[model samples]
Target: MNEAWQQALSRVPELLAAHVQISVSALALAMLICLPLAIWAARSPRVAAVTLTIASLIQTIPGLALLALFYPLLLGVSALIGGGISAFGFLPALLALTLYALLPILRNAVTGLTGVDPAAQEAADGLGMTGSQKLYYVEAPLAAPTIMAGIRTAAVWTIGAATLSTTVGQPSLGDLIFAGLQTQNWTLVLAGCLFSAALAISVDLLLGLIERGIRERRRIWAWAGLAMIAAGLLVATLPLMIARDNIVVIGAKGFSEQYILARLIGSRLEEAGYAVRYRDGLGSAVVYQALSEGDVDVYVDYSGTIWTNQMQRSDNLPKAEMLEAIAQWSSHSHGVKMLGALGFENTYAFAVRPEDARAKSLRTLDDLARVSSDFNFGTDVEFLERPEWQMVRDAYPIRFKNARSFSPTFMYPALVSGEVDVISAFSSDGRIAANGLVVLADPKGAVPSYEAILLLAPARAGDQKFVAAINPLIDAITVDNMREANYMVDREGDKKTPRQAARWLNEKLRE
Candidate 1:
């Protein structure tokens, strides 16, 4: 196997275990709540209507939006209750996924219970059986097959939706999928999809066996299927059970640079004798909050991001002054330590195809504004909503004919393909040079300096050995080296995995 496939396969066991853990937990919780509610709803039409309506409404929400909404909601709740909840990881993911699983199980179960034979229920009542006795003795048996069918549907749905939990900092098969999509690593993407699909199909088949057994009065099939599921769950739980001490958790945003930097950090920590875990594909805001909560031990973030997003500052400062102010504010406000800058500024650079720049005589923001009405603007997904974008608009009277968002991975391609005339490109992206694009100047300096910096959680800020191990990386990487490392993974041919890129970058640091 090639290095990419070998690396992708190596991660499957841990990712698959996490996938099974969360999916099964959500399914089990849904069943616990739904089965009892189904029984009660069967007896009362009003209860059935209200409960099923709520579940149906929940189902209408796109799984990704539902998962994103919980992070802020839980954070608000935590503040109101004096703060014990972790809004980032397993809890939010579990709650959202559990709700996603509810509709199918509740709907199917209610249908099954209410559709039970009236004659059998009546006969049980005639025998002096109570409501509970009738339900346990006659109604449940007849409804078993239908109820099992609902569980089967829910199992499949839950497993599929669980892949989205990676966005909220939860580890699942989605990690591979998200990272793969960012770096264009189809091997990783294929592996994640194949494993998740196989898991869902396998669970569906097992549940199908149980449903058949219940309907056909074949108990052995039901027992055998249930046994296999139990065995699988036991195996999934085993890795999670083996505890390790002083493990460091690293966080990364959903992009190739972030992925490479995270692996870079992890490699250093591992050399220092710390067990490392990564939470990749996190949003900008989610990652900072995670560090504040000490859920993440360390990560890289841009100086301007913390200044504008976290501090709510709009006025631009000199790079050195800005970094100092941010360092003080982070320490005072959130107990997070600003370790140091990484010697590169990955600022937002407005770029265009060389032909367009020369033909249109577009040399700067002012020049571009004159022709803005004819061009389409493309940007990374969050840039349109960021304060820097607003600042740029305020400083220059530029409005495009259209604006569209793409993932960081696709933004460059969209510009090159003429789908967009201009893009808010990253200054350190290797594609800017590889594609020979022209970067327009910002004479007014509307955008802030985005010096990449390392940040440590409060707990790790004072660890002498940990600090010593990572301190050399401070101001060690140049923008040229960073871009080269990024291109190693982002290039269409001879692509290296993030780990390989990180190792190469580490060697560069040493040289």
Candidate 2:
């Protein structure tokens, strides 16, 4: 196997532990709540109808949407309660997964309880059993098989949906999948998928065996299956129990470059004798929010992203001026410290294949304007919604044949394949040079320079060691180094895992 695949496999134990914890925790919590509610509902027709309807309603919300919605919901609750609950990570993921798990378990439990034989209840009552005794001795055993089936179904659903937690800053197998998909690394994606599938299948089979055992009045299979689950939970949560202090949390946005940078930062912190954990693949806005809220310790963000998106500025300032403005604004407004630029700019640039640029004799935005009608434009999803694009459009008389948005991962492939004639590309992206694309110059200076900058969370701003430790990296990474690191992971034939790429970059930085 290749180094990339080997790296991918190395992560399975850690990722699987996370995935299992998330899945089992959510399923276990759901069962605890749903089973009792199911019992109560089985005894009362009105309660059963109301509870089932609510659970079914929760199930109808798309899993991703449900997960995203929890951020603001908990944010508000946190404020109202004077701050305790975290709006991101395990809490929200758990809540969303538990909600998703509820319908299946609740419905199945209700079905099982309600379907209990009337004759059996009468027989239990004739034997001098009270209501609770009848339920324990007669109804529960009769209902065990069906209830277990519901739990099995819910377990599968919980495990599958738990992967989405990666988007909300909780690490799981989905980290591998999301990072892989972004970098077009299928090995990581496939590994994550296979691991998650195998886990679900294994859990389902064990639960199925337990269900069959209960129905046949065989205690051994049921006890053995339950023991396996308990052991897995213990194994999954052991890391969390041991590592509880002196850890730095690093955040990264969803892309190859961010992943590489996060790993670089993590390795540096680890080498400094600090335990480092990452919350990778956070949304651009979400990462900043997490940092400011102290949910994450540090991350790299571009100047222009903070300038226009976070700061809401529209002026096209020079790089130094913009960087200074962002530093001051962030410090004053959000208590976040913009340590310094990373000595590289990853700005928005319009790029075309070299062949297309040469055929059109295009060298600048002005040249593009003359032939704009012939080319279709492509951009990552945020560009169209960003003020930078509006500035560029208003500055030039350029009108493309069509414009479409793609995820960052797909944007370059789309451009290279002729799906789009021009792409609003990130200047530092490795694929731009790797694929031989020419970025058009903007003589009019319509776009802002996106110099990569390091940001510190409010809680860590005063930590002298933390700040000092990261200072060396501020001006260390150049555009060339970044692009090369990105290309190592993103290029089709030559692949390096993010950690390996980070190690390579660290070697260069030391020199």
Q: After best superposition, candidate 1 residue 495: deviation in angstroms?
A: 0.8
lDDT against the true structure, each candidate: 0.93, 0.88
Candidate 1 lDDT (Cα, 0 to 1): 0.93
Please give the TM-score that candidate 1 achieves against the real structure. 0.98
Per-prediction count of colliding residue pairs? 0, 0
Model 1: which ten-residue window has the lowest total lDDT? 236-245
On TM-score, the leading prediction is 1
Which lDDT value does model 2 have at 457?
A: 94
lDDT of 1 at 339: 96
Candidate 2: tens digits of C-alpha lDDT, residues 336-358: 99889888899898999999888
RMSD of 2: 2.5
Model 1 segments beyond 4 Å from truth? Answer: none
lDDT of 2 at 417: 97
The residue ranges of model 2 lying beyond 4 angstroms of the native Cα positions read: 124-133, 366-373, 397-399
Model 1 CA lDDT for position 155: 94
